[model samples]
Target: MGTPFSFDDGTAICLYVINRAPLVEINDEALALHHLSGMGLDPWNPRRMTALRERIHPFGVTLCNNGALSLLTQETQLGWHVPRFISAELAVAQWAREQMGGTEESRNLAEEVEMYLRAWRPHADLIRHPRQRGISGHEHQFDFLQNDELIDVITPHHNATGGLMRKLVDVLNAGDESAPKVRVIVDDRTDPARAGIEMQIIASLAKAMPLSKLLDRVHSGSA
Candidate 1:
């Protein structure tokens, strides 16, 4: 008997009831059949086992070797099923960290940008991280979309902003007349040099509108 093998996909595979019947010792087919029969299942019935696997798939469960079993599910599901496994807040925090690449500073910057946008356009529908299709028919995601504008918040310290900026440019030039106007907000508080580069990229592709300009536009009902 041992702990199951777990995967990041929220699935675990292991011997079933291993404390009593070790998987290695169940060498004979009859023993496997007997073990499955005890659980009210026919070891030879493929359709039944297939149906069972399908039923448990959403819960991240799988069965094998007539006796072995596995459980797979997201962290949220685990927290829900296992009492006191994790607090609701902790689960959400963990999920957010995973989504944001585990960078607290980046997460804070995104939040700041989101808050600013919400305040600026309180009545407009502001979507965070919206997925849209490009000219190539491939889906792409931008940080935020407000009306006819697409906004991205960049951390000056991260060099990946260049690639993201290029993606925005691609989407903008995708021949879609209805494409949103692109804007980027770079936190220039730290690494001002990189922020300058980001600003330049935005300027080259679209208007490198500053935060003040954005606020002004919103106040004047132009955004």
Candidate 2:
């Protein structure tokens, strides 16, 4: 998590991109680079990507490793998806932020992930911070919603997870006969033992998914 370069001017977040086929990023390359963490990228050297190129890990890594965007929306990923008919510039900005993250990043992980999901599936009916009434006639607040799914985001900081289990249990118990599907997006960086125990408690009433796998859950069609 340490910053590797100073003149990076806050660029160089690792991205998973396809290789250029002469004129397009249409094919996947071999695994090579992911630059979010510190290793040995010399900031003052004036030479950057040649070194990054020499160190290229491959497709799962990075090839075109260094550059700046004139505007966030101008950035691209996965080829043909960019500026297709009915294209979304906002989606491109979100993709750019995910790839070339800023120096002063947002601390709101829930909001961040919500935006990520929206960008990837802009046409989906995704609602944020929605309130639904439980069967007990009490209202339950959720971080996100889609169809009948309820997602509650919990973190591993400053007791952020405290009472989440109980609150969710109440919601689950009060759910209707069919019961809406509930998912708890837990921060993956939590302590091992605590996460194990917490996940078990959550699993009894809902799906306990790690923060890192949010998109995976979406892709799996169970988000």
Best by TM-score: 1
lDDT per residue (tens digit) for residues 60-179 in model 1: 334454534443334444434322211221232333233333446665667777877887778989987676555544455566788878777656533345445546655666787676
> Alpha carbon lDDT of residue 107, candidate 1?
53
Name the best candidate (by lDDT).
1
Can you tell me which runs of candidate 1 are displaced by over 4 Å? 1-103, 209-223
lDDT of 2 by residue, 77-160 (tens): 434333231122222223323332231242366677787667646677888756655444445556679666777766543233
Question: Once model 1 is optimally superposed onto the true structure by TM-score, how far is the C-alpha of residue 140 displaced, in angstroms?
Answer: 1.2
* Cα lDDT computed for each candidate against the true fold: 0.50, 0.45
Off by over 4 Å in 2: 1-107, 119-122, 157-159, 190-193, 215-223
Global local distance difference test of model 1: 0.50
